[model samples]
Target chain A: MTLVGLAARNVLRNKFRAALTVAGVAVAIITFLLLRTVLWAWTAAADYAAKDRVVTRHKVTFIMTLPLSYAQSVRSLPQVKASTFCNWFGGKDPKHDKEFFGSLACDTETGFTVYDDMVVPPDVLDQWKHDAQGAIVGDVIAKKMNWKVGDRVTLQTGIYPKEGDWEFRISGIYQAKSKAVDRSTFIFHWKYLNDNLPANRKDQIGWIVSRVHDPSQAAGVGVAIDKVFDEKEIQTLSQDERAFNASFLASISAVLTAINIISVVILVIMALVLGNTIAMGVRERTNEYGVLKALGFSNKHVVMFIVVEAIVIGVAGGLLGLAIGYPFIEGGLGRFLEENMGSFFPYFKIDPRMSVLAMFLAVALAAAASVIPAISAARLKTVDALKRIA
Target chain B: MDTATEKAPASHRDKAEALVSLRGIVKIYERGGEQLKILDGLDLEIAKGSYEALMGPSGSGKSTLLNLIAGLDRPTAGSIDIGGKRIDQLNESQLARWRADTIGFIFQSYNLMPVLTAVENVELPLLLTKVPSSERRQRAQTALRVVGLEDRMDHFPRQLSGGQEQRVAIARAIVNDPALIVADEPTGDLDRKSADDILGILEQLNRELGKTIVMVTHDPAAAERAKVIRRLDKGQLK
Candidate 1:
């Protein structure tokens, strides 16, 4: 038999311990993949943001508003192909009060044009344009809230307190063509929200989004738009869509950093578990190594036996981890997050590259962990090793 | 060196050349701040094609001498020549290579790889050689047959009786066709019937196959099977 074959057989000498080590490695792999998937999904919005679009918000904070005239000024820019403005409605359905989603009052004329990745059918868009009280919901939110066309829904909000709950008819459901688009949003015309507001709050907009003629020149266009508002009563801060999304992510950078650190800690734990198993196996087989040495095997051969055994356990655990992790993360948890937490984790599926990296790390770290034990076994004197009982 | 070494028949001693020769062997071990000398300056020789047994009580250095002769160990100070090569002067790796090519070892516990089958255990020594896999298997099967264990070739060491395991170990030792076989208490763990059976195989290996052997044993009955017997006491021949 080959030396490798013999070493593989030795792995089964303590079947229970081998199984436990493999299980430990598998659990670590799963935890690592879960943390990595969270980090990937969290940054996905920034990663997939449109390069050609720029957002202009109040310079001080998003809580304040800009005059509706600012939307016209942004549209008048030479580099701006189209522009849209929206105010955060902060509206929640009275029926499902606990469920959270994006609610926005957007300019009907340019909303779909600037945010082109929000796909709505022509018939539905035509119908919504004619109805002042009609609303267009995302397909995800529509399914979540059981809203269908022609259904009247009432929303309550603390920010926009009115005489009664706001009411609107469901006009259409939009599907997202890009991962950056939140699939759980509710959108209605800005004019409807404007006409219902008090005199002090009327004609005020939250933010303006403009699509540039050249994506590469988006940064220059953003500077030009902010320059237009420099002398205005309310100053504006303008950035490209990618930068806007990145700033939002930077706010929670600590959480992401913690997840990354936890991923590394899990890998270290896996290595320690693997290393301990290898050390114990080497200790138990000290006498067998002496027999091998006396039978003419070199020190290198003894090391090979130990390293090969560890490699077998490592690879087995990796395959098993992938087998369980793929479905557990992709099929079950991904679906739940996409349906419920779409605003935060719009795309929650596991990254194929991360899976490959996890498997590679399993084998590499396991071999690395076995280094001390393999060296100790190789350096053992044949006579001294033979003196040990087992 | 006086009368401690008893001479065999002159006819037997004069007919063969020396296959193993040791001069001024000294083995010292440091244990808990004290230097314990296991073997003092000693000299000995074994003729080619000889079957000799080394007998002594515990701590007599019989096993140490056998280990030195087998190249499984190095003497602190000595010149050990086996098959005309100075083994004591060779490095650890070089001695390992030399042992693979020249010496086979049998231990009291059989020392068979519990994970491997009888045939696989026999094939262990040949794995170091450039022999093709098919040839290694054939040689292993033939070795097991010589030990009368062809039917148990696929059995693991744990599945076999103590006597059968020892035979498997013997098959492993002779599988590579080494020039010398050194067995340390080969029959120590076996019953009287099993011990006799093992001794008969050792006799067959020495007589029929003409293999030279040096064995260390505490049992005189086991030593009597050899052609020549030497007694050791306090690390010196008696």
Candidate 2:
């Protein structure tokens, strides 16, 4: 038998204990992968953000609105190719109160132009532009609510109170071409919303999104836009889309940090489980190690046997984790999260590189964990070891 | 035993070259902050191809002496020359190589790997050498055949009787054709029939293969089969 073959056979000497250790390591790997996927999904918005786009909002809070006149000033900038303004409708269907989705009242003409990644047919765009109360719903929301193009729907809003429910015609359905964009939004005309409001609130818009000619200069253009309103009654905060997404993520940084810490803790737990198993095996096989020494195998050979056994266990556990994790995360939980929490997790999928990294960590940590046991086994006196009965 | 009739004369043994020579050997172990000497300044020699048995009571340093001769442990002080090589001067790794080339071992508990089959256990020592896989298997089979356990080559240690397991251990020891074969209590755990079987195998290995065999045992019946039986009491040969 080969030395490696001998080491591998030793792993099966106590099948039940080895199986339990392997299962424990598999669980740790799954937990680590799940936490890493959460972190990855959270940062995916920023990673896929459009570089050519800038968002301008209130300096103090996103809840506050900018003056409607600010949209014109943003559009007039030389670097800006197009611009649009939208207000958060915060509307919900009374029939499905528990279901959450994004609702926005946007400038019908410029909304479609600024959000070029939102794909709508020419006929549908024409129909939406002419109708004052026309709405464009995302395919995901359309499928969820079972709303058709010609169907009329009513929504109740908490932000903008009305005497009765607001009504709109579903003029079109839109799909997202980029992962950064949510596929579950209800977009309607800002004019329809403003015309019904009192004079004091009529000319207020929530935010402005502008597409710039040069992506590299988008941040500079955002600075110029904020500078225009710096001395006005209300100040504006402007940033490129990626920085804007990052700022939003910073508000929930604590949750992300917890996930990161949990991921590391899982790896530590995996190492402990692996190390304990190897140590136990070494203790139980003390007499066998002595016998090997008597057969002229050196201390280095003894160390190799223990370390290789641990590595095999680690790799086996890693494969088991991957087999269970890929289906559960990418296929099962990912679909549920994308459907239910599309605004927070626009794209929920496992990163292929992360899978490879998890496997690599499993083997590396297993080897690291085996170090103490290997040394202990190698340092045993041959005569003393042979005297013990295992 | 039939093989005892083939034992060489004392003059023939004296004329043969010495396979092992020890000069002023000493071993000390520290316990509770005090030095405990196991083997004193002892000197001995054994001719090549001799079958000898060492018998001693508990704590008589019989096992320690065997360990020293096999290069499994270093002496606190002295020189050991085995198979024309000065083993006392060799470092740990060099001594391992030397032992691999010159020494084979059998244990009372039949220290065959539980995970490996009989043939696989025998093939273990060959992994240290540059032997090809096919030739290693063939040599291991041949060794098992020499021990008359070729039919049990595929059996695991747990599947075999005590006598059969010890035979496999013997096969593993001789697979590399070392110059010296050292057995510690080779039949200490066996029934009388099994013990006699093991003793007969040792005698046949000495006579047919001409391998020098040094065995440490507590059983006088086991020692009686050896051509030369030496006794030790309190670290001195008697």
Candidate 3:
């Protein structure tokens, strides 16, 4: 028999203990995958932001607005390819109060060009631009609310408190080119908000999304745009779209940190469970180890035997967890996140990298769990070990 | 240094001359921080092919004496010379190497690795040597054949009966053709018929193969098969 075969057999000496250890590792891998997915989603906004796009908002807060005249000034720049403005509708469906999505009042003609990654068919784009009271919804948002073509939907905006309600016709449904982006946004014509506003609030814009000639020149153009508006009464904070997303993520950084801490706790629990099982097995087979040593096997061999046993347990557990975990996330968690938190997570399936990392961790943790047991086994003297009964 | 060791036995090629000599040996153990002397000064001479038995009571330090001769435990004080080399002066790792090369042991209870088959258990000792994998297997099969267990080479220790397991253990011990064979109560756990058969096998290993045998046992029937009988009481041999 091979040395590895002996180790594998010894690991199965206590069937229940080996099974428990595999279960522990599987649970840890699941927790680790869940936390990693949250971290990935949180950081995806930063990773997938448009490189040639710059956003200018009110210096004090995004809650305030800029003048429509600022768009005219920004469009005048030589490096500026296109410029569009959008105001947050802060609108919610009265029926599904908890279901959130991006509701924006944007320049229908220029908004589509500036945010080209938010791709829609030519017919839908033309239809959306031609109809003034038309609102185009994302396909994911359409599916969730079960809205159809030519459907009239009313949105209640708390920010722009209206006389009764604001109504718009569903003109088109848009999809995201990149999975990093949410496909659940509802974009309406900016003129609708402007027409409903009082004369004092008219012509006010929430934020400007400007596409630059080159991604490398985006920062310089952003600076120049902010400089042009610096002389005005309202100041601006101009940054690349990625930095804008990072700032939003920073607001919920604490929650991400908590998930990370809990994930490490799960690893510790896995280590403890695996370590305890190894220790017990080693203790029971102390005399057998002495017998091996008496037969001229070195301490290194003894340690290798134990470590090999742990690795087998770890690999088995990791595979079992992946077997269960893939469907659990994709079929169960994936469906829930896409339906409820579509604004934040348009696609919530497990990434290939996350699955690989989980498998690697299982093997590493299995070997790591045996470290103490191996050392203890090596430290035992032949006479003392032989003296140990059972 | 004693001339009497040469006259003991000169029977076979494995033991053409005297190899190991013990002058004085003692072993002491510390338990619960209290010193307990297990073996006092004892002297024994063993030649190359002598088959001798050491008979003793439970407290007679027979196992302790066997451990010292096998180079497994260090004597508190004394010189143990084996194969013209002083074993007591050697380090623990060096002693282990020496034992692996020159000494073989069969315990009262068969100590074969439970996971291994009879052939694999026999091959374990050859792993310490520089033998190739194929040669190790060949040598293990040859040793199993010598013990009349070639048919059971593929059987695990658990699958073997008491006597067959003992035979496998013997095969593992002699797989390297060790010059010295030490059996401590080798037949104590077996019934009379099996014990007699095991003794018969040991007799063949000694008379035919010329292997020097040092056995410690409480059974007079086992000791009667040996050429010489030595009795130990307390720590001294009489």
Q: Write the per-residue lDDT of candidate 2 for residues A1-390, one digit (tens) a residue.
A: 689889988889999998998898889888888999889888988988999999999999999999999999999999999999999999898988888899999998899898888899989999899999899988877888888998988999988988788999999999998888887899999999999888889889999999999999999999999999999999999999999999989999999999999999999988988998899889989999988887879999999999999999999999999999999998999888887888887788888888999999999999999999999988998788888788
The superposed Cα distance between candidate 1 and the true structure at residue A170, in angstroms, equals 2.3
List runs of model 2 lying over 4 Å from the truth. B1-8
DockQ class, candidate 2:
medium
Chain A TM-scores, candidates in order: 0.96, 0.96, 0.96
What DockQ would you assign to candidate 1?
0.84
* Tens-digit per-residue lDDT, A235-272, candidate 1: 99999999998889999999999999999999999999
Interface RMSD of 3: 1.9
Q: Rank the candidates by lDDT, best first.
A: 1, 2, 3
Query: What ranges in model 1 sit over 4 Å off?
Result: B1-9
Q: State the weakest 10-residue window (summed lDDT) of model 1 chain A.
A: A334-343
lDDT of 1 at A24: 88
Candidate 1, TM-score vs. the true structure? 0.97
- The residue-level lDDT of candidate 1 at A268 comes to 98
Higher-scoring candidate on lDDT, 1 or 3: 1
Interface Cα RMSD, each model: 0.8, 1.0, 1.9
Q: Model 1: share of native contacts present?
A: 0.82
